[model samples]
Target: MRTKVAIIGAGPSGLLLGQLLARAGIDNIVLERRTPDYVLSRIRAGVLEQGMVDLLDEAGVGARLHREGLVHEGFALSFGGAGHRIDLKRLSGGKVVTVYGQTEVTKDLMEARAAAGLTTIYEAESVTLIDWETSSPRVRWVKDGLAQELTCDFIAGCDGFHGVSRATVPSTAIRNFERVYPFGWLGILSETPPVDHELIYVNHPDGFALCSMRNPMLSRYYVQCRFDDKVDDWSDERFWDALKSRLHGEAAERLVTGPSIEKSIAPLRSFVAEPMRFGNLFLAGDAAHIVPPTGAKGLNLAASDVRYLSSALIEHYDTGSAAALDRYSEQALARVWKAERFSWWMTSILHRFPETGGFGQRIQQAELDYLVGSEAAMTALAENYVGLPY
Candidate 1:
């Protein structure tokens, strides 16, 4: 098979990029190692920045999102046993965030691709990229016990952190920066109304907790946990109790408890592989960098990466110039580092680190106090929360 771009992975990044390129009259193919159902079944973050929402609109998948996604003008930061609202709209020049699950976003993209008759090969086995350093690059994979190969002008490595894309790059050529936290997020999805209309971030002496939702009826909640904690260690009742204990007054009183439909522990980490582009191969989303989820920057960062990449590719094809492509790495990395910093800063202030001791706890309280009390601090938080400009 021959194409202009051979994309690895069928996740949001890969699918979104394919859609953008196809609409631009570029030919591309997406390869996924798992079944479509499997891909959609994976639950993920629900918060969407305005930038990501705009990208969805550009991809022609924003109709449902705009209809169903919850819009929050502000979110509450709870500390000292009280909830304090940070007016995002007022602080960040009237910017806001949308609460839309990643699963729904992927579904919309997948449906759009199918409706447009775009090609996406699922259950592709042993997917590998070959000769990405040269002018002509090829992708090889196994399907239905048969081997196949594709030739393309460029390769997009949207296959995620454990996928073959990043691993394909020689370690000698890329510098890796990583900080693995000692804690993890123990989260659960329940079929119940959320405690608050807007998301609530709690910083309790015990730990950090976040009350988020997919919709009015489906709530997603998380609390900080030890790295070794397992799903079995947290029953539905126990999880509800822990979550409520961290909340204060009205938030705790308004909470609706229900059986958890999904439970898991996700480790917190900040990782970035410098130089997102390697020759003809480019990495977007999780393949290039990962941020702690405290600031809800993980998926937003991915969307920003895709924005830069798609713009660069579009310019390259339109003008027959590689100027944009040549600067893809530097351009993407600049925003990536800022998000990394924001996520790291939020995690540091909100989370209960085991080694932080008493001094660190006091510092966290002070930061939260200043953030909610000072307009400048609140504006900074709102700006980062609504997302930096693409």
Candidate 2:
């Protein structure tokens, strides 16, 4: 197989990049290791920033999102038994976020890709990305039982953290920065209604708790836990009890559990790969950087990377100049670092670390109290949460 551009992943990043490049008259192919159903059913990030929403709308992919997504002006931050609302619209001049899962975006993009006559290879195993240093990058894989090789002028590594593309790049060419937290997130998708009107980010003595919603019927909640926690160890009763205690009072009343759709523990970490490009290969999304889920910046950051990467690829193709490509690493890193900092800051401030005690804990509480009470602090939080000027 041959194409102008080869995207190795069918996730939102790869799919959206393919769509963007296609619209720019650049031919591309997308490959995925998971089936369509699995990809669409996987529940991930559910928040979309203003720029991301606008990008989807302008790309002609926001029809369903606009109809199904819940738009919110802001979210609530609860700490020290009080709720402080950061009005996103007031702070960011009408910028708002949407509560829609990343899976939904994948579904929309997948449907769009299919309707546009694009074929995505699923359940393909033994994939290997080769010859990235050459003029033509080759992607070899075994789909079902047959061996195949795909060659393209430019290759995009859109696969997430564990993908082969990241590994394929010589270690000498990459500088990886990572910070793994001592705790992970125990996220649950319950059939119950949301426990709060808006997303509630709660900081409790026990841990950090979040109350988010999938829609009117389903609620999403997450609690901080040890990284080694197992789902089997947490029963439905125990889960609800813990949640109720952490949420407290009126907030706990909203967590009426009917049935749980999904339950899993995700380790919290922040990662970034310096110089996201090397030779003929360019990495985007989770393949390049990963932000802790606290700030809800994962999907939005990925989408941002795709925007820059796709545009750079288009420029390279149109004029045969590597100027855009040459600066891709520097350009993408600026946003990546900002998002990384914001994510880290939120995590450190909101989540209680084991080292926090006595004066440290009191200091954290005071900071939280002041942040909620002060308009300036709220605006800072609102601007970062809604997005940081991009």
Report the C-alpha lDDT of model 2 over 1-390, residue by residue, as the tens digit.
889888989999999998888878899999888888888877898899988887787566899999999999988888877677788999887889999989889988888888988767888788888888889789888986999999999889999999978988888889999999999998889887788768988888889999899898889888888889999878777777777888756777656876677999999999999888878899999999999999899999998888888878889889988898888889888988999998998898788898767777788887887887788888888888888764
The runs of at least 3 residues in candidate 2 whose Cα sits more than 4 Å from the true structure, single-residue gaps closed, are none
Collision pairs in model 2:
none
Q: Candidate 1 at residue 296, lDDT?
A: 90
Worst 10 residues of 2 by lDDT: 246-255
Q: Rate the local accuracy (lDDT) of all candidates.
A: 0.94, 0.87
Question: Highest lDDT: which candidate?
Answer: 1
TM-score of each: 0.99, 0.97
Query: Candidate 1 local accuracy as lDDT?
Result: 0.94
Model 1, residue pairs in steric clash: none
Using TM-score, give the best candidate's number.
1
